[model samples]
Target: MKYKTKSRHIFILMSLLLITSLVAACGGPATPAPQAEPAKMEEPAQTEESTQTEEPARVEESAQTEEATTEETTETASATDSTPDSGSVELPEVDPLAVTGDIISAGSSTVFPLSERMAERFQDEGYGGNITIDSIGSGAGFERFCVAGESDISNASRPIKDSEVESCQSIGREPVEFRVGTDALAIAVSQENDFVESVTLEELAMIFSTAETWADVNPDWPAEPIQRFIPGTDSGTFDYFVEEVFDKDEEPILSAGNLQLSEDDNVLVRGIQGSPYAIGFFGYAYYNENQDTLTVLSIEGVAPTGESAEDGSYPLARPLFIYSTAGIIAEKPQVGAFINFYLTYVNEEVIDVGYFPASEDTLSVAEASLLAALK
Candidate 1:
């Protein structure tokens, strides 16, 4: 019984040893089971992610290119619609008038400024050709207009004398009258002369006529001999002054023999500016142009300005004129057009140039008369 029990114990021990060896051979506590790898599926996912990122970059680059194209197109459109920097615009090429010929105008020195301004503006606005203007005195201009058929237009500082109009009719040229503006025959002296301020119309007549010395008009004035300057007899300024002041018939003062006569207002300005005792009269534009050296004199306690002239406060104010030949208007449509432009576009410039624009009604009448004469 003892041997059999001992053999059984040995067998159990052997079995226990065999199981322990088998566990050790398979794996110890430090080693774990190997896991299966999903390499094929993971590889395809990584490749797809890379493709998605690169596609966004391509899309961003394409978007940038499209933006650049849009900007370029906008710039091109802006350049195409830009205005030219040159002052000349692209105006239609059309003749502005029916008649195209040379224009010759001569008239009052007073009207010369306005007429010349019209001619200049007309040429700039693309009139046919050169419009020549002569600043001959009014009487001389009338003589030229009346003798035969010389001047196309005559500017007169005064209304046409009946004799002058008759002379035009004798030559078969009917004169169509147009008033351009108003003027104040400005009397001026040296700016340095401060004592004499104002003068009466009667005093002006005395001073301009044969009154040889300043003391003759007013003993209170400078006892120095009055150095007088007068516009020539041919001047419309002379005619207006004589008619208004001397009752159209008074003989000139014989004492005025020492007076200086000049056809040019500029000459008169220099004469007055140089002499302390000198007094002279001319168009207001001359005084305005030389205000530094010449002092305009107020007449009868009234100053001469556009407002004053309009209100009739300025005693020396007078209407100025332009006389067009009826024949010229009928024969030349450009002449009529030029006249219309002068009355329309240049009225304000006329006043700005130191002459007074006529009333609107007067201008309308003048325009109507011009159109009628053309018809």
Candidate 2:
């Protein structure tokens, strides 16, 4: 009975030792190792996934910023190059004469300075071969221009008369009219003549006509004889003075052959400037050129100037004209170009040359009319 009891005790001790060893081996090999390996692997995977997501988002944001910047830069560049800041566009660079082809322009000697300046500028810009201009009396110019196929342009101090238009139409041509600027027909005397200050329209008529002496027009004036220099019958200036001041009536003194007549306003200026008692009338440009030697007389107590002329305060103000043939513009590219350039530069250029620019509304109407006629 003692030996059997001892064998059972030994078997029990062996079973307990085996169970403890198995538990330690299973726990060591599986529990702690699985937990450590899963944490290490999962941490790296999660970090990589987060890194990939953030990189793509950052790249997209950077691309969007770059695209927006590029678009803004492009828009700014386009705006700077296209629009004119001053509301007026710089004229496109073009050879004015070359664009027009061969050009022929003739007109009022009074309108000569502006035309000559334009022609000179055109030539300087390489248009010398394309343009030729002449300064003839306004009536003579119209007479030639009205003849069908005669001339490309006619410059005039006055608008085309109904009779002149009929003359053009009779020859199978129509004249398109353009107003370039305003003029003040100034009555000038020698700078030495201090007796005269101002005169009314009625007084001008009397002074130009039957009044042979200054004292005849005004009893308080000097007794010296008043010498007169008048433009010839073919001058538009003469016609304007006749119509505006004389009521188109024939001057008895002019009919009596007492008035000195000349086609050249320069000659008239010379005649007046040479004689202290002499008086003559011409366009403001001529008066401006001879301002040193001549004294401009106020009409109805109003001086002739750009402001006064524009406001109708100057009685002698008149509209200057450019008459173009419709047929010429159709057949000649130069004629169209010349007209366009003239209209484009006239506002500033006309004023630069001692003439008044037309109002903006008038210029707009003229440009629209010319463009439509060209079309």
Candidate 3:
């Protein structure tokens, strides 16, 4: 019975084994193969981390670069905006007939004739406004224009003094200098005097100062008393003379005997023409106007000609200037118009008035000054 039972169990085991083999053949495997989903999931996680961190950092870097570029552009624009206008400034044209209002100018006696001529022409061209010009000395002129604030313009032979400029500022005015023409300071003697045709700078200084007689200056000259006629201390001409001849020391010339000082060049001219021993120095225009009675002495072998003055060869050649404030120009439109006309037509009348026209460069600068005042 035991052997029969063992044989039956072996048969059943053999049948079960055959069934399992058939199932394994039909399906591939009972347990599932390791899934690729986990590796794919890890890849997505890494990609998300890169987008959140590394990609944002790159984007942030790009944003920073853009910000730097914007700052650079702003700085470049600022730098450009701060630069001064160095290009040519356009001068406005004047229609004198259409303008109206009074204009007052006072200053140097040397600039008086030129300013007077311009004023006449402005009126002749149909300007209806009254233009008053006073022939006060430069110091007095500045006193009126800067300190008292009475004049619209100030005429000057020499540059404005710092103290005068400060005075202008005290009255809410900033004086602007406009170069109008050039003048040679004429050292003249009576036409009847044939002894001196020229003089050295040293001899010229002595004749105006220490020398008591013509013979004291030169042995060949006659022993006549030196009659010295000079511009007054208030005159710009006086200031220039003292600066050039006396090393800015006025004591020598001021204390000299036979010295006569006048604000009017006409007075000096008449005084100088009275005697052969008489000598005086004033603007070339005064000498030119009275050339028949006066003989202009050459200094250091250089005469006061337009050519010599323009070329800077003449030692006493000086620039003639007119000064006005921007406030005045704006307050009086007629003043602006008149200055425009003067600057535009100055050359036409300057030569005829016995003064040299300012150089083209200088005229342009004058035009620029007018332009600035108008603005």
Candidate 4:
């Protein structure tokens, strides 16, 4: 009756493994536990996410409690040691109904919304086990996974670092990746603002970093000062922004005037809503959700859209990821099943979550990688 049933199938699978071992000891061919056919999970209706950083679309919560959910309660996760295999392969199919056991993941606050959406769908499709998604910054998430060795999956907006890979190897866990979707880092202003509609990378760099007033960045603009709202230092969104716009230099933006930083996107949204001078950025899903109250500024003459993001027309578009190891998936089949369900259903959920689907080819590549790892 408890949430920590530890999964009924896991116990049965363990019995099969023991039988296989005994058969091997008797010099007979061992029988492996059978994998069920991939389950057909009904896709959830897409929900609109807020477009502004001042607010976050709420994730539906269930009243069911997790008192006995005695799974991995650690705050951080272990980074698994793994490498990329770029062959075109088939996506893994999973029977979500057969999957069980708790799933613990934490990472990029930017990727948090999409992951949360997927996790909810997994639960709705008859998953009784616990699933916890933490919105800690990606760097912190990596530390949890790579240094602490606690999570089953590490959600990230960017790829794992080389040093992170080495860290995972040190702990005997090989990190495997699954590309889930695409995000357009929407640079947003309140809908009340009319003077600003779009900006170039140079203007953005100036606005977020060095410029004290709107006039400093653009001669035609008002002399009003710019208000900056952004994700905190540990955020992958912050890292991506600095890398792309500041060319990896943090000083200019970090020391910028009238800046407020937070790990939550909603904080940025609210900060921007307070004044026409305010501006902030986060994933497009937030923008889409809050479309009524916010305006997403085009970058480099191209607005952030699913078409633009997938086709690479959007300058701020980037791929999203979740990292896990084959070893972990094998040991905990529930993780494998959850990932399978995620990949299979993400296209439907991604739009609802306020992001774009990766191209069929890209998704297939991710699926292929997962299928290979589960072996």
Candidate 5:
């Protein structure tokens, strides 16, 4: 009987020790228990004073626990050290229905279709207010936004010129630029014309400036008069073309014979499609929209695909932009909301509208610009 009683006491003591270890392991550093660990380690069921024989062991364990806690805290602090150097800016997701009031944006006949599509989507997704996007040329658009100060937003196929910036400043506005997408200028001709599939840079320049007939540009072709259709002087498309082909000199192109110019790309498109001898150039989206009736010529043997445009392989690829002042955005909260929505969802709509999406890095900069303006 004595042996059985001793065996039962040993088993109960071991079980108590196991439970005490588990309870100690589960205790968190934040929980107040300075003396609890010492007490538990020294005695399973007795007070600290009654189990003083193991006091030294408890002290050592308490010191080790403190050291462990210090190490954990150091690790946590290192993990949370966040100082931004460079990356994407987080833009707020827009709920169009929650946005109110009218937004007026004008400029860039090239960007008009993309902006129009976005506005349509804003309305389709429950935006209740008005969004007016005018299809005037980029220069004319900036004139309205800066010199006239009648517009809340100005869209451009090119960056705002220094003079335009001064105009904005004179009106108590500092323009902010947001890069939205890239466009590869499409040189197109009527599909009925099969004489040329591509043209070199040298030939392209003459085709618009000096060449009066198809045979003037290339031999072994019919000597048909070269019907030249081009964007008007105020158009950003015209400016970009002149910069690329004429080294920014407009005299040659302006003096060319049989030249036709218009701010409307549709008019240019219709003119180019009217005759096999006709040729013109405009935004890739315009060519894409009228592809069935037009054949887009390759420049220097390189065509304008999304990849080519994004990679800078296409010679005529150019960045598209929209300009607005912080004052305008702040005064018209609706304009700010619309721009936020534009930056947030442009990639989803850009490709379908016939332009390539801006690179992620470029788009992030635009988002950062908007955030800084809002602040």
Candidate 6:
């Protein structure tokens, strides 16, 4: 009985020990490692300290940006100072004979005779350097001046087109125009033809395009087939004729039968001289050269002559031009000097070249333009 009571006491003691261990596991305080770290997050932030540390770097970046901006502004102003505007340019009167350097020019077959004469006079006056002039038409000349950037000067029978100006601007060249002379375009027929002396604009158009026979143009005339000769499409004269006479529609004239087109005005003169039925138009200089072989026609009772061209009496009269930029003049002093000489002497030689001298006001304006460009 003593041993059994001792055994019951030992079992009850074991049961109490196990119950105490379970209560401790279920309800005792945790170590709280995660919660302790969360409170530490509320302490002094290192980000604020890092931001303060980067303050100097931000200031430095701003300073660098401002410096770059200032540099760019300075460079822009310096560039502007280097290139002067044409309106503000001023050129001093200088001697052309003392100038040197080769001159390269292209454009305008009509202007060729005038330029050639000027070049000869320039050489006679003592310019030893070669002056090369090309008669490659105005459009081709602009291409050489603007697109190719090859020629120092471009001669044009007509003013530069908007497209040509755009081309020059694209290549960083701004063309300046100088009116050099006036041209009287002459319509000529073979010397053998004496029946027709004058024609109206309508009759001229009909003769060149729609009229197949002389009777087609006029009932009183004979039924001879009409022959037409004209400048090539590349010629500025062609553009002018199409614009003025055909209303810029070239199809009627270009599509006509018995039509001959040539870039050389001399060829056109020859073509007209070949047959009495043939007729053609070209610069007055060409007509003047072949006057014996060809007959100059009276258009609407107006004849082409220097006085008629200058006085604006001739219907086919047009202005002639030569172009050079201010930059070109400054860079090539010889070109500038040559232009000065040409302008001073053009009026004297223009008649010899079969063109008219520009009016006094026109010459003055040209001189001012040149002076302004060179200033």
Q: 3 or 5, which is superior by TM-score? A: 5
> lDDT of all the models against the reference?
0.72, 0.73, 0.81, 0.78, 0.82, 0.78
Superposing all C-alpha atoms, what RMSD in Å does each candidate have to the true structure?
38.2, 36.8, 36.9, 19.8, 28.2, 28.9
The digit string of per-residue lDDT tens for model 2 on 52-132 reads 322324433433444433334334434543643333333332344334235666668778787877766666665533354
The best candidate by TM-score is 5
Residue-level error in angstroms, candidate 5, position 146: 0.7
Model 2 has a clash total of 1
**TM-scores vs. true structure, each candidate:** 0.72, 0.73, 0.77, 0.76, 0.77, 0.75
Which ranges of candidate 4 are over 4 A from the true structure? 1-92
lDDT of 4 by residue, 165-279 (tens): 9998999888998999999999999999899998999999989988899999999988999999998898888899899999999999999979999877777888888899899
| C-alpha lDDT of candidate 2 relative to the true structure | 0.73
Flag the better candidate by TM-score, 1 or 3: 3
Task: Pick out the ten consecutive residues of candidate 1 with the lowest summed lDDT.
Answer: 45-54
What's model 5's overall lDDT? 0.82
- Tell me how far the alpha carbon of residue 297 in candidate 4 is from the true structure, in angstroms, after superposition: 0.4
The list of candidate 2 runs beyond 4 A from truth reads 1-94, 97-100, 256-258
Model 6 weakest lDDT span, ten residues long: 45-54
Q: Give a tens-digit lDDT track for model 6, residues 157-220.
A: 9999999999999998999889999988888999998788888888988988888998899888
Please identify which of the two predictions, 3 or 4, would achieve the higher lDDT against the true structure: 3
Answer with 3 or 5, whichever has the higher lDDT.
5
Clashing pairs in 5: none
How many backbone clashes can be found in candidate 1? 4
Q: Let me know the TM-score candidate 5 reaches against the reference structure.
A: 0.77
Write one digit per residue (lDDT tens) for candidate 3, span 138-246: 8888998899887788999999999999989998999999999999999999999999999988998899889999999899999989999999899999999899888
